[model samples]
Target: MTNAADRIAVSTWSLHRMMGTTYPHNLDTLEVGPVTEAYGPVNESLLDIPSAIANHGINRLEIVSFHIPTRDKVYLGELKSALAAVDVTLQTLLIDAGDISDPLTSDRDTRWIASWIETANELGAERARVIAGKQKPTRDALDLSVKKLTELADGNAGSAVRLTTENWFDLLAEPGHVNFILDKLDGRVGLNGDFGNWGGPTKYADLRAIFGRAETCHAKASFVDGTLDEADYAACIEAAEAAGYKGPYTLIFDANAPHEWDGIAAEKAFIEARIG
Candidate 1:
């Protein structure tokens, strides 16, 4: 049995897609932040999210970078203040940059990423979720990523933030690749495990292998022929716990449905029940 300290967390992205809406009423209504697009070009509705989530009994929030203007700190500060007013905690911030695996490193990309790290620090975020970049033409790309990530980590060393690189291709498709990256990085980085993204039947097994190294997780569920399967989800949760992982688990619902929030709540209940 898992201890109470090992409770799973539900990401608002799952609820956002489930509800078919972004930025639900307020944190007071949904305890989760709907994955929203950046408002105009600079602002994010951070204050509004916590209230909606608070209403729904959710105080923890994982803000996706796609929703916030990564270049502007002043606007970010405003958003941060709004969250602080409602006692909302920023759990994880995801940044989706173009081709993380691209071999040709750009000074512009590096600068943009540096800005992101700074913004994450200002918001007091615990971790930043980054794509594995673009897939490279040669194996040397892995070494390049390690060097770049190490640099990012070094810059943020004084802050609370840690860089978590997520698996895009089959890089993390198996335990070997997962361990390979961890071993090469030497604990300087960690994995952001996304349950539904794995391409094949090995999803459950892969989760089991990497759970111990997960700093944060993305909980994604699917509807097979219009029905939600609890058994598949139960297996994912079981794997997470069995590996002795105790951290925040965010639910990311990617399906498109009008009343998807109901499904998300159900999944959360199902996982929480098993955790008990």
Candidate 2:
């Protein structure tokens, strides 16, 4: 039988600061410079993450594309073996930073996403998460996103890895705009609902409008002075359930906790207590 906790996964991004020293969030496009070279020859091993999460009883992972130190097949194979050793499911490979909204850059962005899809396949990941766009949400941008995303999906036909996007960046700031693109793509792409991505008075209402379409969730909790806001966390869960969302709640622990695992454990417990 699958335990309720089994349905939960932890994203490597939750440990971004902990995994290694600071570098650009978009490590994929780093230019030749001190910041770039300092990040070169990754000091941290991606291999350690899977087993670390398994130690906390979480058996799934969503790896950020930038965190992948090397794209060499051998290194990926070793990472895949590490996950299997700990029985961790590589749920999604998050490909951050790109703008398919511009016609000038759409082709390059599409090809970049395709490359991650290939890497996701190599790592046995079930899906890859790409940023919708950093550009302002306009009709033209939406159309371009649809075109590039469709091309990416069509290009990777028959691959086991699927594609997903989050309610993130400028273009996806509003739920209506998010729905517009998802509606156009139909089911060609998936949504990875995130709690902290959108906030303010209408956050829950916005989430309610789209949670049902979520294939997975980045269950991020807000923290103030290193303490979590339970009221907001509970409401986020309520909103998702009311919207009929029934998908894995990947605990996203981004806080100033002394230990990353503590934040993860608390978030996981909070979600399980509310949902289960």
Candidate 3:
């Protein structure tokens, strides 16, 4: 059985902008402050996420590297050190590799992606979150993405990092498309399920279809009138659990408000109640 503590993790992306008194790039320079004051000044570029975890009572963290500039090994090392100093471990690294529909794939983009995978492994990330981006529905483009992802996964085969793509746009967003990609790639690639990004009505069913292939998940809660739609939220979690997912429920609260944190806490409570 999965312990409740092991099954819940908060995304630093949710509070990327707030954590310390000053936006220090290294852990030694960070000035720990009250949670309320740290809510809006923490720069994602900096590595103060450990301080966020410490003050927020959250143990697991999903760090988004897209917010950080790419291919800077020195900066990546500093960030990793900061997290280590705070005793906060990374669960996954979320990245926007590039546009899947780009006709001629850019070598520069591919190099950056390879470097991103290296950095995630160095930071001790168990999985890397990638998105297929906007799709133009071309056979060549889809084939190129699959090839690139497979190569990426192979490159990191010996490491703890696994490459997982999220369903977005019209290509990988459909259940059929997800199955196709996963089956074609086999174990070389996996899914990063985002509950809010499904573009259809059967959100729960769609999630269930891809759950078997999922390596990580994002609990993206879109609020209505200061409260999440309880039914939708519950259904998503239920489908994930029913599919035998026993991983941390990573939360991504993108709403803009001081009470957004409150909403996140409430959502966490709701998920915990159901899981427990």
Local distance difference test scores for all models: 0.64, 0.83, 0.70
Instruction: Put down candidate 2 lDDT per residue, 151-213, tens digits, no spaces.
Output: 888987898888899999889998999999999999999999999899989999999998999
Could you tell me which 10 consecutive residues in candidate 1 have the lowest summed lDDT?
23-32
Each model's Cα RMSD: 6.7, 2.9, 6.1
Q: Residue 44 of candidate 2: its Cα lDDT?
A: 45
Q: Candidate 3's residue-wise lDDT over 68-180, tens digit each?
A: 54335677788777878877778888765465445454334555566667878877887887666456656776777777777677778788887888877766767887777
Q: TM-score order of candidates, best first?
A: 2, 3, 1
- Model 2, residue 274: distance off in Å is 1.1
Compute the lDDT of residue 86 as modeled in candidate 3.
75
Q: Which prediction has the highest lDDT against the true structure?
A: 2
104: Cα error in model 2, Å? 3.1
Off by over 4 Å in 1: 1-12, 15-46, 69-71, 136-138
User: In model 2, which runs have C-alpha deviations exceeding 4 angstroms?
Assistant: 1-3, 22-44
Count of clashing residue pairs in every prediction: 31, 0, 2
Best candidate according to TM-score: 2
lDDT of 2 at 82: 98
TM-score of each: 0.81, 0.91, 0.83
